[model samples]
Target: MTLQPKNMLNRLLKSLLVSFVCIIVLSIIINLTAIKLPILTEASYERYLILFLYLIVMIFYVSLLFDQLYLSQKAKGISLFFYLFIMTGSLQLLESLVAQINVQPKAIVDVIVYTLVITSFTVLIFRYYGKGAESYTKRIKNYFSHQHISKWLLKCIYAIFLLFIAHYLINSMLTPFIEPYYNGRYTNILKMSHHAGDVKYVSMLTHALVMVVGFQPLFALWKGSKTSLLFWFGFPLFIILAFQPFIFNVHWPLGFRFPLFIEETLIMYIHAIILVHLFYVPDETHKEEELVKSKLSLSNW
Candidate 1:
């Protein structure tokens, strides 16, 4: 359903406020209940990643809840964007939790249990509360047919996610190859001795750029009303903020400056776009007679 241009901005304001409050509450709860737990409170990198994951979940929850309540178009799109993340994250979280409890390394039973649990939760959320109806889903599918350029851009965007996967896999494989170099030592901060020469500033730049590009589609979904603007202006804005530092500062490359910037920019844009899109884009499809009139169904209202 098309939104009236007049009240669109006002609706977006309300959606943003609601999303902010929800995020705050969720953040507090996560910090209070989960952060203090024995597994999480430890100073492990895995624990830190899990904390970040929880924050990401809270962001998606706010976005999805706003879409469900307000039938926001942008929120719906962002919700779709978050579905992929939530599914993948649920898998990781389940595995991590099971391993923590069992005190085993890559236990098959733990893996299976975690996989099933994550899959079930993801399926339930999508089946019951997913935004946009069947018709809108169809429209999104149809969008792929006509928008070859966008589809290509999406592929380019996905290449970044693939790079991360590659990094993870390569890091694992290289551990065996380079074990002799460090003698399989556990350093407080992981140092790159084998790939010391390979890991240059350019590699760091590539990593940063790939990360930002990875979520461009979600940014696209966020800026649905201004898709062209997002592609043209918003993207540049993000690139400048996320990448400019690495271009300038070359000292202490080991610190998380680049990665943190990428993630921060991602979350900010995600929240902003989710807020604006939620109330501005209504139910995806309008009935034959509904478009002729101003009012939507009582169920929608």
Candidate 2:
């Protein structure tokens, strides 16, 4: 389906409006239930607003970019809910683990309940809309041929490894200059040294992986067609999403100064750009094959 600019704008505005209302309602629910979720209690109103905006952007990214994968609106809605739940749940789980944040048993139960509800919704959606529908697996396999997929996977792996190395090297080099500032701000308060260790490495890897994988839909849509509206929307959106956390101070596993933050975020953008280029760069042979397939499909229609 062709997404006109006006339609895209309307969809985005609707998503933003709905997301705002949902955030308010969710805040009320959390307050009423007295569940102790991480970051919800201490965060300011502005932070919550940023979080809601990010959630809406993610929904847009999935719904518009991967529209072909789902059979109907119901499937798309269920998938969006699943993605939101999994994304927030994974973040909570990771924060609890790495940041040593305290999460109450009631909160854990709440998370499980929400998960089950969404999972059930997903099953029903699939049962109804997915019957005799083209599976996402098949769609992906067709869009990205086996050879392209293999090559892209290797490139992603190499890019990630290089990212890790650059992260280590950059951090090491900047430690002397930035350590004093970081130490002054957080060292005594957190009672942790500024030196690198397992936690730092683990956090870096986690951040890099999340950044790369989170933008996979954007990559896929761009690869399918550079002229796609989804590609145009997603390209800048991806960059903004990468920088949002820092902009809002939403959550950071470790503390650092502006310089370090900019460096790290730039590295992430580079990683994403490399992955997109490696996966989407058009070759004459692949273009010819795609053109032929397009003609055949059109003729069949």
Candidate 3:
């Protein structure tokens, strides 16, 4: 399947902007109305919101990659819908796991409801779609052809901000996990199959690695940059350091006392930033140049 044509780019761009605005509005409403919503208590609602945001971010990222790799709108659409379904289903499964662990049915139904919506979307995508499968890439040899220092610097600064948020999140989650590893019960808990506490820690750490390192690079590549040379190498190193909790724990504290509340919020923002960057930035540098060439030729004619 080929990626969507240039004609579709404008539509995708608009959709992304509108979706972002909607997300922000929703966040504001949720915060303002938090006390009134029985279903959205501070602690439980925060977790639910994080999971919800993660699912949306994953959908956007996977769809962009599918578009790049398959080169067809139909394929991209289907791939996105399918990924959302699987992710939602996985969240429900996680709820089930957590329920079994804690022996409580706390906040699982909300997750299931979200999962159902994603499944329905998947069905819609599979019904009416036509496209071919092929690899599509834009080759632009010179990104510096039309230099705008202000815009370039703004984007770079935004990227740096995202990296910083990622760093903070990795530190916050890992420290608590690390503390447990150095305790006397560590070996026994590792051997035990039913240590839900340890499971939660390990799961978060592993998913953080996947999201920051694995998913983040695809987002970077989709933005028409050299993923391997720029982000892929650097991100893995960061992830490795962040994963220090899984190894040794008897070390000096890094003083990562960042508030958990803010940490969760920043992670979602970082996810959104990465996904938004990848979606708006076409991987083929040649794609824009080709359009410019076509226009010039028509003018000459």
lDDT of 1 by residue, 56-165 (tens): 34333433333433333443444543443332233223222311111234334433432333333333333334344444444445444544666656655555445444
- Name the candidate, 1 or 2, with the larger lDDT value: 2
**Which candidate's lDDT is highest?**
2
* Winner of 2 and 3 under TM-score: 2
Worst 10 residues of 2 by lDDT: 93-102
Candidate 3 lDDT over 112-220, as tens digits, reads 4433444344333323233544433321222323346576556555554555456445545654644544344444222324575565555544443344433332343
How would the candidate models be sorted by lDDT, starting from the highest?
2, 3, 1
**Clashing pairs in model 2, backbone N/Cα/C closer than 3 A:** none
In candidate 3, position 4 carries an lDDT of 59
Number of the candidate with higher lDDT, 1 or 3: 3
Look at candidate 2 and tell me the lDDT of residue 255.
45
Error in Å for residue 213 of model 1: 8.8
Q: Which stretches of candidate 2 lie over 4 Å from their true place?
A: 1-5, 34-63, 66-133, 143-145, 148-156, 169-178, 184-195, 206-223, 226-241, 250-257, 281-301
* Backbone clash numbers for all candidates listed: 3, 0, 11
- Estimate the overall C-alpha local distance difference test score of candidate 2: 0.51
lDDT of 1: 0.37
Per residue, candidate 2 scores C-alpha lDDT tens digits across 118-219 of 344333322333343455445456546746667767766776676567666666765565455444454322335344366667755774565456545434
Which pairs of residues clash in candidate 1, taking residues 3 or more apart in a chain or in different chains? 72-278, 73-281, 74-277
